[model samples]
Target chain A: MAQIRLSSISKSIDGLHTLNNVTIEAAAGESVVILGPSGCGKSTLLNILAGLIPPDEGQVIIDGQDWTNRTGRVSYMQQKDLLLPSRTILDNVSIPLVLKGTNTKKSRTLAQQHMEEFGLLGFENYYPRQLSGGMKQRAALLRTYLFASDILLLDEPFASLDAITARKMQIWLKDFAHKHSCTIIFVTHDIEEALLLANRIYVLSARPARVLKEIALDDSANSTMVKEEILSILDSETGDTYN
Target chain B: MKKFINTAKKSSALFTLGLLLLLWEKGVSWYEIPAYILPAPTQILDGLLKHHQLLIYHTSTTLLEAVAGLSLAVILALIIGFLLHNLRVLYTAVYPLLVFSQTIPLIVLAVLLPLWFGWGVLPKIIIIVLVCFFPIVISFLNGLDLVDPDQINLFRSMGATKWATFKMVKLPTALPAFFSGLRISATYSIMAAVISEWVGAQRGLGYYMTLQQKSFAIDQVLGAVVVICVLSFIMVKIVDLLNFLLMPWNRNQLVR
Candidate 1:
């Protein structure tokens, strides 16, 4: 696990400021969630952290080293799962390993060892299109894990799955995070998911996103009051009660 | 049920072509139309059988020219298309010229080929490459351009090099489009060969047809035209088979 500190990441996309001096930190082995309204630049922030896009002004420090604008140092799981449709599940899961210069035979052997952990053991020979949505996301997560980075940035990874499956994945993810050393930065609009998975949660303001509130849920404080407080703050910001 | 319907559809197509041929034979005989104008189906068939050996030899020569030119065009298109795709500046500067080149008729290019290379296989091969490579280039470029942005992002995040990204992701995605280009270019390949052969080759369907026409052997001329049509159709079929083999995921879409 590595400590990640994002310093004053400001970004403008297509003439609109998306992240306004946004700063956050996740300690080693800690789970941090960026909870925001839809279209509030959560993905933009994750992209900056992933080094896919450099912020107009920012610094990202991972494991006490400045790693701005450098990629492949952190694993990234995008919202869509993004499994290569042409590749079999084993082949898809082996991509990060392959990218790291491992031979296909070795990579598939390594990927196959984790198929049961991913609950995708028998589906290894199937192409991505044959798998259910939940299976694809788990396979994608397995790939991200295999990327071997100490920090993982997940952008709404389970957002497309059905509610039940998403919740089940969250529980599985939390257990996995507890066992793994990587620091996970999860971005989600689901309040319940944030409450369940995060050690610390940052509620971001709509558009030109800045941190509105930071809630620490480290102590077994799964109270209804905390949910109401987060809800009220979000409801005031978006003028909607649904969040 | 699906298999039955497919078989029925194939049979109906054959039946329609057969009926049309029968009508042509009956009409020619009943109207007493001169053989010089449009030969009956039986006459064309007789002509084909009569010159089957000679026709096969010329057909083989023409086929060789088309296959050579088309294979060369594909190799060239792949190399140039990839270079242009990666070098956007070069693509921007040269893409219009490519379009402009397409407007120059194949017939004109065929004429110029003889002047440039003289009466040889080289001129015909060059002309075929020129005509067939356009669609190949365009389709390949389109496929390269259509590489998914998300796929690119994923590759970039993984710190994959540009070449690795192309080899692993872009190439697979571009295959269907490349095959599409191949299909269009396949049709052009044979036509270009025949047209080039028409200008000066000594042994091909084009040369055979010209010699027959000069002697008013309408049946033989029609027979050469039939061979050309069949050859082009076969090219299209071969491309389809290649497409099927190369892209297994796309097979589901071919069901309709």
Candidate 2:
């Protein structure tokens, strides 16, 4: 069974539909990217899938259970790094375990094991404010991963990063997810980002957004060819065929 | 070398204090001013030494009242701040009443509380709580409410409940602001307690000063004033130390 299923998920805000009867499914360990323009409700859809917000109408099924009204099945990392300024990087990463009632000592130990994987081992004692923008995002990602949920929702996690840093993060994330066999629903405005990471892409419309197209990329394609195809698809959707 | 520089700083501060005393002594000698008008610093020190036991007793009583009141204010402020922060309707409803409470003068509160309660430590402590509560609540609420909305949403998406969100995010973020208000309230607590004692009390620093003044012991009165200033300064320093220990992140971010 698909680990996460959004069945005819419809959401309206202020009487305007954002997701118009959208349905998508991701099998366990698959990486699906929701690609769209600025106001396309891609983040909103990710939020619904994570159970952050309830859809106005429809069901969100995870592991054969309706999680629309249920909670805690999915872990999400937002666009901005929401590291607590008062907490050390180690404490921030251990927060999910702490919330689950794990002892502080054990939680810190568990968090310490993943610090080197995220390139944050030495900086564990540093507070959030001591970190650079890129490092803060890394800490936030580590925190989300530490939650150890079955499904992960990443809402433009690298959107705030500089172009160079963002590219590095994209590569790191792809490797990290693959290594863990993690199920992910990632959202992004960058077509290149979607092409680089996603097995399947769901492109969305401008506002009051609905899915415009869903494309499956050849898993064996070179990075250059994949990037070119995604750019072409985006150009066609935006009616800007200047490329 | 750094230790020497720190010692130099302390010595310079002491030298300035000595210079001020010299100037005061010259003025007293030149004008042949009556001791009742303005006693010399040395005379104040002498008077303080002579009545040290009595001063200690009264100072302790006043300190106890202030400490108790300040503790109560902090607890009430945090509870109210947390409640209002979680519930917007309650915040809007109660915020104006809190503001109104602050507008009432401390002197009026001193007189009114004694009438309401009695001529005891309870009334004085109540006065200190009244004076200190508003600043703490206002600052705490501002801190709690000012958390980044995106941050709140981020935690929400992670399936963090309201209490968890507060414990993990809101409370830690609000610590700096809470401590800032607490510093202000701590100083206010001492002053409020002393003033309430002035209005009605038989034993306290304020009452001791009054008794000394009545007996024409101006030097002792000056001694009491000095003690109060020193006490207030110590309380502020303690709060600063707490801020250092609790929110170490702020230490490095100083603009200077």
Cα-based TM-score, every candidate: 0.96, 0.89
By TM-score, the best candidate is 1
Error (Å) of candidate 2 at residue A53 is 1.2
Give per-residue CA lDDT, model 2, range B93-181, as digits (tens): 98888898777777987888888898989999888888889889889988887799878876776667789999878897888889889
DockQ of 2: 0.56
Candidate 2: give the TM-score of chain A: 0.92
Write the residue-wise lDDT of candidate 1 on B175-225 in tens digits: 888888889889988888888887778889899988999999999999998
Residue-level error in angstroms, candidate 2, position A212 = 2.3
Q: Which stretches of model 2 miss by more than 4 angstroms?
A: A220-229, A236-243, B1-23, B87-89, B248-256
- A1-243: candidate 2 lDDT, tens digit per residue: 888889988898787778888888898988999887887788788778777788998899988998996557777888878888878999999988887788999999999998998999799999888888889999998888888645678889999999999999999988988889989899888888888899888877676777767877666767687566666776776787522
DockQ for all candidate structures vs. native: 0.74, 0.56
Question: Which residue pairs in candidate 2 collide?
Answer: none
TM-score (C-alpha) between model 2 and the true structure: 0.89
